[model samples]
Target chain A: GAGVSQSPSNKVTEKGKDVELRCDPISGHTALYWYRQSLGQGLEFLIYFQGNSAPDKSGLPSDRFSAERTGGSVSTLTIQRTQQEDSAVYLCASSANRGRVLHFGNGTRLTVT
Target chain B: AQRVTQPEKLLSVFKGAPVELKCNYSYSGSPELFWYVQYSRQRLQLLLRHISRESIKGFTADLNKGETSFHLKKPFAQEEDSAMYYCALSDTGANSKLTFGKGITLSVRP
Candidate 1:
């Protein structure tokens, strides 16, 4: 079976530009999450979506960061006015409803120059 | 707020030697602990969870509520075990969003 899939394996952009990272969760997985992986910073939770209810944006570092999951399957994390501080590997994960295990994608590495 | 801590950044050991990766966490309520591993060029994957109490790839972790620790251990190390390990915590609530620690790198030399 296919695991979580993320697009644009690597992206380099100039500061102040907007970037959108996409994620395709495995079929039937209802929960989707985005995380930022930085050197020495570990995996920082960005946002989470569970079913159709309100999304958990508590982990978003700032208002510049936002994400939306359409049809409860595909998700896109959008960063407005990217900053060098935002450079990191963005990871997407999914799990079944109430399932404890999280299947992760290879992640998209974003670098702001 | 819940927090996971992997105090050490790196550990190096020879093959066949015992390995222990330390992990400690802090949370207000009862939390679930998990160990995630990432091999070179591979995506992160679940290695084990405390609730399962099952060993995978010769690795096992025991959750100690009194100490707030869920350290991963292996009796004998293998060169193939070299990779990054992350400790994560999930609250018992419905959300189950995980809080991960700064991962530690294990280098198992042949």
Candidate 2:
């Protein structure tokens, strides 16, 4: 089975620019999640989506960070006005259902130059 | 609020030596604990979950609600066990959100 897929394995953006990272969860997966992995910071939860329920955006660092999972499948994480601190690997994961084991994608490495 | 803590940033052990990776968490309600591992150049994957009480790759973790801890242990560490390990907690049920720790790197030397 195809695992979770993320696009743009490497992305370099200028400060103040905006970048959108895409994620395609596995088929039949009802739960999708986004996380940021940085040196020393570890893996930080960014957002989560489960079926048709309202997504959890609590972990989003700022208003500039937002995500949308359209049609309950693909998700896009957009960071407006990117900053140096935003340089990190963005990971996407999907699970069969809530609280299930997650399958992760290769992730997109975003470097703010 | 939910938080997972891996106090040690790194752990290095010799082959055949016992290994223990400590993890502690704080949650208001019943928590679902999990251990995720990432080998070099590989994506993060589930190593084990507390609920299953199963061992994977000779590693086992016992969830101690009394101590609020879930520590991963192995009787004899192997070089292949070197990897990054993360302890996580699920915050919600229907819309479960995982809270991950800073993660700890385990290095097994021959």
Most TM-score-accurate candidate: 1
Docking class of 1: medium
So what's the TM-score on candidate 2? 0.97
Each candidate's fnat, in order?
Answer: 0.68, 0.73
- Model 2, residue B26: C-alpha shift (Å): 0.7
lDDT digits (tens) for residues B9-44 of candidate 1: 999999999999999999989898999999999999
Global lDDT of each model? Answer: 0.93, 0.93
lDDT of 2 by residue, B1-110 (tens): 88899999999999999999999999989898999999999999999998899989999999899999999999999999999999999855667788899999999999
For residue B103, model 1's alpha carbon misses the true position, in angstroms, by 0.6
Candidate 2, residue B88: lDDT: 93
All models, DockQ values? 0.73, 0.73
Number of the top candidate by lDDT? 1
